[model samples]
Target chain A: MTNEIARPLFATALRLTRNRDDAEDLVQEALYRGFRSLSTFRKGSRFRAWMFRILHNVFINRVRRQQLAPRATDPADLAPSDHDHPIPDLRDIRELPEVADRHFDERVKAAVDSLPDAFRVPMVLFSLGALSYQEIADALEIPIGTVMSRLHRARRHLRTELADYAREHGLAPDPHAPEGAGS
Target chain B: MKCVEFRAQLFPYLDGELDEAATGTAAAHVADCADCAGRTAFERALEKRLQTALLADVGALDSVALVAAARRSPPLDSPTPASAVSSGVSSSSTGTSSSTRTGRPGHVLRFLTARRLLAVAAALLIAVQAAWFFCIPPFECSYLQAVERTVDAEGTPLRPGVVGPPLAERIEVTPEVLGYRLEGEATVVDLGLGETANSAVRARYAQNGEVVHVVWSDMGGAEPSFRRKREFDGRSWWVATENGHNLVAWMCPVTESLCTLVSELPEERLLDVADKLRAAER
Candidate 1:
C-alpha cells in the first residue's frame, strides 16, 4: 500500500532533488510525517497526489532556504552539499534546452530539467497532471496571477528555446512560431 | 486595443481571467484584428507545441518518489520555526481550511486501508514478504503459493529499536520459506515473547475467502489467533499471524475483469517488523 503511494512520489522527489540518496531519505521522511499526520487527510481523494504535493513543498522549501542562505559567509554552517545542484538560474536553463536532440527522451527530459522552478512546476502540473492554472495555484500555494504569469513565461521560454532547437536540428518551424503580422 | 496589449494579456484572455470589461475589449479587438489573432494564435500555438514537447516529458518525472522524499525532509520539520510551512501561504482562514481539507485523503486511506496497510506497512514487509514467499526462505507456507492477492501495506509495521548499526558480517536473508532467512551466527531477539510480545494484530474480517483458512497459535496452540481468517465486510480474509507478525489475505473482484488476488504469507508482516527492528537496533 505504501509502496504504490510512495514510489511515484519518490520518483518525483528524485527528479526534483536529483540526489538518489537524498531522494530516498526524503521519501522516508515524508511517509513518517504523512503517517503521523494521517488524521488530517481526507477520504476518497487522491492519496498519491496529496502526498506528492507535500513532498514537492518540502523540496521547494529546502531549495528556497538554500537560495536564501549566505553563500561564502556561511559555507561552514551551511547545509550539506548535494551532487545534483539545482539549476537556480534562468540563463543556464535557456542554454541547455533540449540537450541537442540526440535522443528524443533524453532531449525532452533535459529540457524540462533546464527550466527554473517557477516554469518547471506549472509545466509539470499542466503537462504531467493536466491541471488547470487555478489548480496549479492550489497545488503550489501560489496566487492565480503568479500561476498565469509563470505559465506564460514558461510557454514563451519554451518557444524561444525550441525555436533555436528547430533551427539547430534542421527541424521544421515551431508550430508556435509567430505567424504573419503577429509580431 | 492594440495587438500589443492583447499579446500581453493573451494567456489571461484565453483563461478568461480578465475582468468582464477587459474581456469584452479583448474579444472585440481579436475579432476585428487579424494581427492580434495571429499573435493570439501564435501564443496559443506556442503553448500547444510546448505541451507536446513537455507532456511526454512530464510523467517521465518520477513525481511520486520526489514528493515522498520531500515529505521526509520537510524544511518545516528541520528544527525550523513553526511558521515555515506557511512561508508562502499567509496565515488565513481560507488557506488553513484548504490545507485542513486537503488532509482528508490521507485520513481516508488510513481508515479504509486499515488491515492491508497494517499488514504491509513494515519497511521490510514487501521485501520480506516477497523474500519469504519467493525471494527468500523458511516460514513460507505452502498454502500461500496457491493464493495470490493484490494487496499493499503502507508505512511500516516495526518500531525502531536501534538504527545505523552495520549489518552483521554473516547476517543474510535467504530466499526459502520455512527456513531461517537470517543465516548462521545471528543474534535474534524475539519481540513477541513474554513482556516484549505485548503487541497484537487488530483483525477486521471480511465475508469472502472462508473456504480454507489458517490461524495464529495462541493459548498454547489450542487457541490459535494469528493463523486464522476472520469474517470481515461480507468476506473472510485468510488470516495468518506469527508471534509478533500479522498477515491477512482478501480478494476483491475487478469490476471490469474477473480475477482473484490474495494477500501475502503468514510471517511476512512479522518479518518486516522484525527486520526493521533489527536494522534500527544495529
Candidate 2:
C-alpha cells in the first residue's frame, strides 16, 4: 500500500519541485506527516486523495517558509496573496493542432513545468488520471469549477507553447505565413 | 448542442465526468460539427502527451526506506516547545560556539523508590517476552505460513490430511479453476495439533513467473479483517498487503468457506485472479 501510494506522491512532488532531491525530501516529509495524522483518515475513503492533500499542504507550507525566511526583516512580505498568473489569449485552443504522438517528451515536460503553481497543480493532478475532478478539488480545497477552469487554462497555455512544434512537424498550418506560402 | 454549450462541456466531456445526458449531447455535437471534433481531438492528444511526459522517468522510490523514515520522524501533533529545543540544537551546531552545555546535577539526591524499581523490572520482563515471541523462528502468522509452505513445496505431489480424506477431495479447487492452469496440487494445512487439527486446503498456481496461492478454510466467521474493501464483479473482497505480499480474502458462496488468495503480484492483478476464482465458483 505504501509503495502504491508513494509512486503518485513522488511523481507529483517531482513536478512541483522540478528537482529530484527536493522532490524526495518533499515526499519524505509529507509521508512522515501523513503517518502521524493517519488516525484522522476515514476508512473506505479515497486514500490517495487524502495523501495528496497532505502533500499539497506540505509543499505550500515549505514554499511559504522559504519565501519568508530570507525576507524576515520586511513586514510586508508576510502578507498572503493569491498566486494567480495572468494568462493571455494567444491562440484559439481549437486552432491548435494535435501534438505528434512521439518525441515531444522533453518539450511537454518543459511546458508543464513552466506553468504557474495555481494552474500547474490542477493540471498535474488531472494528467495523472489518478483523481477525479471532485477529488482534485477536495485535495486542493478549491471548488470543482476552479479545478476545471485552471485545467482548461493550463491546457491553453500548453497548446500555445507546443503550437510551434506542431507546425514544425507539418501537423498545423503556420499562422504567420501568407496564404499558399507552403505550397 | 450549440458550439458554446459544447465548449463549456469540452473538458468535462473529455474527462468523462459529464452525466449521461450531457455526455450524449457533447458526443452528438462533436460528431456533427467538424470544428468541435477537431478541438476535441486536439485536447485529447495534448492530454495524452502531457500524461506520457509527466509520468515518464519517475524513478522508483525505496518504499521501505521511506516508511522507516516516516516512522522515525516526530508526530504531527508534537508540542511547540519541542520545536524550540530542536531549533536551539540546530542553531548551536551551526553557530560559532564550540563549547557544549552540561547540566549540573541537583544537590538533593533522589533514588528510585521500591515500587518504581519493581515497575521498571516488570516493564523489562514484558519487553523481553515480546522480543522473544516475535523474534523466535516459526512464529510466522498462519496466513503467511501457508503462503511460505505453498511456495517452498512447489511441484511436489499432493499430500493427504493427517486425519481426513485426501486434501484434494475435500476442496473443489483445481489447476484450471481460476481460468488458468496452476502448476501444483492441493495440500491440507493443519490448523491445530493432533485430532483437533482444523484442516484447510491450499493450492499453488504459477504463470509467467507470478505465483498465487489459494487457500480455502471452513473456519466459520474467521475471515481475515482488512481495512480496504473493494467491490469487483459484483462481489466484495477484503484487500491488504502483508510482508510485501498482497492478500485478497472473500467468502466463497459455493463452498460456504472463507477463501484467501495470496501473491506477490500487484493488487490489481491479484484482484483479477480473485475475480476469476469467483467466476469459477459460480
Candidate 3:
C-alpha cells in the first residue's frame, strides 16, 4: 500500500530533512511505522497523507528528543506570522543573474532551509502539492488556522526571497503592473 | 468580501479549503477585483513554481526492499504467528465418547440383572478380608513398628528412636582422604556396631600438630538437625559446637552416610578440612 506513494513520500522526507541520509532514514522509519500500523489505516483515506503524517510525526519526535535547534527553540516564540509580518510588496527585490534550473532549485531549497521549523514544516507539506490545509493541520497537530497562517507567511517570505533572486538575475517584477505582481 | 478580506483568504480559496459561502464570496471578490485577481494569479504561479522546485528526486531510496521487509515482519499491532493461540475448546462429544456412553449402561444392566450375585460376591470378599488383615488388627493402621523413646539402664535419657549409623567397618586412609599427609600419626577408629545399634567410623587426622576428628555415620534417612547450616552445591551442611570442637557435618545423599568433621581449628578451617576429605573421596 505504501509502495504506491514511496517515492513521493521519500521526496517529502527529503524536503523536510534536507540531508539525503537523514531523508532516507526518515522515509524508512515512516514506511516501517506505516506498514506496522497499516491495519489502523482507514480504508478510504489517502495513503500518501498517512505516510507523510507518520514521517512528520517521526521527524518531530526525533527533533524534540534530540533537543535539536529550531524545534527546541521556544514554539511560542516561533509562532508563524505572529510577530514577523511579511512585507507585501514584490518590488523591493533586485534583478538576478541567470542561473541553471538546478541552481534555481537549490535556491528554492536554501529558501526553505532559511524558514524556521514552525513555518518550514507547513510550507514543505504545502509545497509537496499533496496534503490539504486540514491534512497539514492534522499531520502537524496544529490548527487549520495556524496552518493557513504559517503557509501564508511562508509563501510571503519565499516570494520576497525568490523575487529578490529573480531581480538579481535581471528578471525583475513588472514595474507598471500591480504592487505584488509576479517577479 | 472586501479586497483585504479576499487577500487574506487567497491561500484558502486557492487551496479550495474555504466553505461554500466563503468560496463564493472570495471567488466573486477576486473575479471583480483586478488587483486581487493579479495577486491570486501570482500566488498560484508561485505555488506551481514552488512545487516544481521542491519536487524531490526520490528514485534512489530502496522502497521496494523496505516494503518487502515490512511485509516480512508482522506489524507491531498485528497478532504474531508465535503469539496466536486457540481462543477456546468446544466440548461437544465425538465418536470417541461412545465408550463413556457404553460404560454408563453396563452398571445399570448389571445392577438390574445380577443384584443378588453382586451382593453374594461382595459379602464373600468382605468375610475373607475380615479373617485376613483387620480381624487380626496387626495389618490395621496402628503404628506398632514406630521407634519409641527409651531411658538407658544408666538412668540417662537416650535417643533409641534415632534410626541409624550404618554398619561400616574401620577404614585406613590414603593421604588423598585428608588431601594432605598428617604431620603426626593418625588414628583410625571403628565406632560401628552390628544391627544392635547405629554404626559409625572415625579417622583422627593430625596436621601441623593439630588434630581433626572426621566421623562418618549412616543416618538412615534421618534429617540432620544442626544449629548452624550453610548451603554447598545445593545441599546443606551443619556446623555444630561440641566439647571445644566445631563439628561440620553433612550427609552424602549417594552413600546415605552422615559425615562429621570435628576440628580444634576455627569453623572455616574445619569446613576446609571436611571439604578436602570429601573432594578426595570423590
TM-score of each: 0.37, 0.49, 0.47
User: Candidate 3: global Cα-lDDT?
Assistant: 0.49
Which lDDT tens digits does candidate 2 get at residues B192-271? Answer: 31232134455555656655555444322123323233555555443543323454422221121222322244666655
Best by TM-score: 2
Once fitted onto the true fold, the runs of candidate 2 whose alpha carbons sit more than 4 angstroms away are A68-103, A168-171, A175-183, B31-39, B62-282
lDDT-superior candidate, 2 or 3: 2
For candidate 2, give the DockQ: 0.14
* TM-score on 0 to 1 scale for chain A of candidate 1: 0.61
Fnat per model, in the order shown: 0.14, 0.22, 0.19
Q: Predictions ranked by DockQ, top down?
A: 2, 1, 3
DockQ per candidate, 2 decimals: 0.09, 0.14, 0.08
Query: For model 1 chain B, where is the 10-residue window of minimal lDDT?
Result: B251-260
- Candidate 2, residue B108: the lDDT equals 17
Kindly list the per-residue Cα lDDT of model 1 for residues B13-103, writing each as its tens digit. Answer: 7644566568778988999997777556655544444444433333433545444333333233323424423533111211122122224
Across A89-182, the per-residue lDDT of candidate 2 in tens digits comes to 2233334333443456667777878877777878777665256788889877778877877776777677666766666666555523321111
| Worst window of 10 by summed lDDT in candidate 3 chain A | A91-100
